[model samples]
Target: MKQTTCRIRCVNALVLAGVIATTLAACSADPGATPTTEPTTAESTSPIDRFLTPTESVPPTAYPSATNSEQVANNVVSWYESGGEEQITGVRDRSKEIYSHHAEDNWSIDFSLFFDRSKEAQEYPPIPDRKTQAAWSTALKHVRSGASDIYMSNQLGIVRGSKEVKREAHGWKELAQGVKGLKAIEARLHREFGLDPLTSP
Candidate 1:
């Protein structure tokens, strides 16, 4: 009986890991893929609330579809690059559609210096500084995925922050200065994680 229980437990753990690996893999397909959302007017139909509050936590057994989350994030990024943040509350179109999509899963985004979903998480780690943010490749759960400074910079194409920005020398510029898209990221975060795809703003 004891041997059976141990076997079952190990099997269960492996199954769980496989499920997560599958979800993450599916989401990560075609990293360079473009947004599927058709372009529309930049006007936003999203209420201010979606960006402000955290999404209701799902049960641990309720795994998220990384693919869908990735799509939503991609659409929002397209909208943002075209100035979606500046064009809030206007005629509705592609921007509005994508924005609406994002609001549906705002947690998947990382707002960086713009929002504070970090405080909203039920089980989150302490806020990390610039150095730490750049190092962590895994997405943050409580905040969705869009809260880190380095994470968003990579999404916006300002810096090559595809992963951790490593260094310890003196001549390095401040994180804010190096990443021009940072302020835009932060402000939009004020507007909005998953997977820009890690969350800290």
Candidate 2:
């Protein structure tokens, strides 16, 4: 009876050991069964990733297009006669608003080239006569000067107050005269050259 009881005790110990081995093998085979700790703050977030992501930026305005002299002259006349006037007036109307941030951006892009006499000659076709050429030159200078005054006034933060107000009004007056001068010059050149004016779109 004692021998039988001892054999039975050994068998029971072996069965218990086998059960433990099976459980260990199952855990090893299925790693996903184990619970994982949450990631540390440093692992979950990175300053470089947060701040270095690429972002869209504003593009520079395209320069006005004109390949030849006649085209350049026509472009200048069209811009001054219509586009420039509309842009300046729009900006003036919106000067008191928050959304007028880029009010003076168009001046340099559209009109600056005409102010450079050498550049103007190189880019534009020759006017038919000395008289018309003189008129053209004067008109460009006036327009450039007037535009500069307006641009500078905005740049210098002279938007309000009585003195600055008067200065801005004066600038507007000069700009109007410049526009009128440009119109007259355009007409003379068109008549002299027999070139048709570009129709406003």
Candidate 3:
């Protein structure tokens, strides 16, 4: 009976030795190595960086929309007659205010002569295609031959500045002398360029 007990103990010792040896081999095979299943090329990017890869821009430039207010304003006047250019030039003289702000984190943006100009659009070479026409681009246009009123949109609703050969801004709601034609301009701006006529300055 003593010999049988001795034999059972010897078998148990051999099984324990095998388990320790297998565990040690597995741990040493890849010391400090990352798991093979994880991805190595994963990355992250911010909202602004996406503009770098865009292929489309207003006026079709590889660079940003307008270098400065003067360039855009001048380009607009080129589409107008000499007398109209001189008149439109006077109002746009105020450092060329362009509206480009988006509020409440919404995709749609409001533009206004009441709102000051922002050069934020200049930073990017190619801006990402927007959901609507840029407000500043619409604001810059004037008739090459006919008359156009210099209108400003603010919280008080649409306001007309001037329509006659001479332009002037007298007050917020009322100014200038011409047909209601400027209203159509504002309407077209809102429709094509996302200018919320109701948006405040």
Candidate 4:
């Protein structure tokens, strides 16, 4: 009877241990179903779940188109006739006012005017090569002619002054003296055969 009681107790303990091991194995197997494995890893409380994230593409910005010379000339001429040149020339006239304040007095103004004149000339288109035989020969003349009204006025003044100077200064004695000097000029000097500077005044 003692041997039977001891055997029953041992059997009961072994059965209880087997049941506990089985429960632990089930908890480890299904982590979602059991709190033990679930708490081992952090919970993702995000409102929505994602697997592969979507990518976005950004487009480059484009710049504005530039105005061509023909359009620029048309616009500039229209603006000038509407009193733009008068306004610009008024500002340019005040160049003298700011000249002294600059680092290199007078130098910058001269260079600035030179640049402005060059820039203004390119504002108009060139005459087509097929236009005429004299196109190449007279291109500069047309450019000078088409320049703003103020430049044309200055060119006219220059021509008028040159004519007046030639008329007042030329004489037979002056002509003969210029010719004699041209003949006598030293070959080594490479001096040009041109008008005598003294006779001009």
**How does each model score on TM-score?**
0.18, 0.36, 0.24, 0.20
Give the lDDT ranking, best first: 2, 1, 4, 3
lDDT string, candidate 1, 14-36, tens digits: 99999999888877796866666
Candidate 3 residue 125 Cα shift, in angstroms, is 20
**True-vs-predicted CA distance for residue 18, candidate 3, Å:** 1.0
Q: Select the stronger candidate by TM-score from 1 and 4.
A: 4
Better of 1 and 3 by lDDT: 1
C-alpha lDDT values of all predictions: 0.35, 0.50, 0.34, 0.35
lDDT (Cα, tens digit) per residue for candidate 4, span 58-98:
11122123266454334433433333333233323332222
Q: Which consecutive 10 residues in model 4 have the weakest lDDT in total?
A: 186-195
Question: In candidate 2, how many Å is residue 27 off?
Answer: 95
Backbone clash pairs for candidate 2 read 69-124, 69-125
lDDT of 1: 0.35
CA deviation > 4 Å runs, candidate 1: 31-201
- Provide the RMSD of all predictions against the true structure, rounded to 1 decimal: 26.5, 17.9, 16.8, 26.5
| Candidate 2 lDDT tens digits, 121-171 | 324543434465566556555555555555566554445567655664565
* Winner by lDDT: 2
Q: Following a full C-alpha superposition, what root-mean-square deviation does model 2 have from the true structure?
A: 17.9
lDDT per residue as tens, model 3, 14-117: 98999999878777785775567755544355444556446322233332355765554443333222222222233333222221121233223233322231
Cα lDDT of candidate 2 equals: 0.50
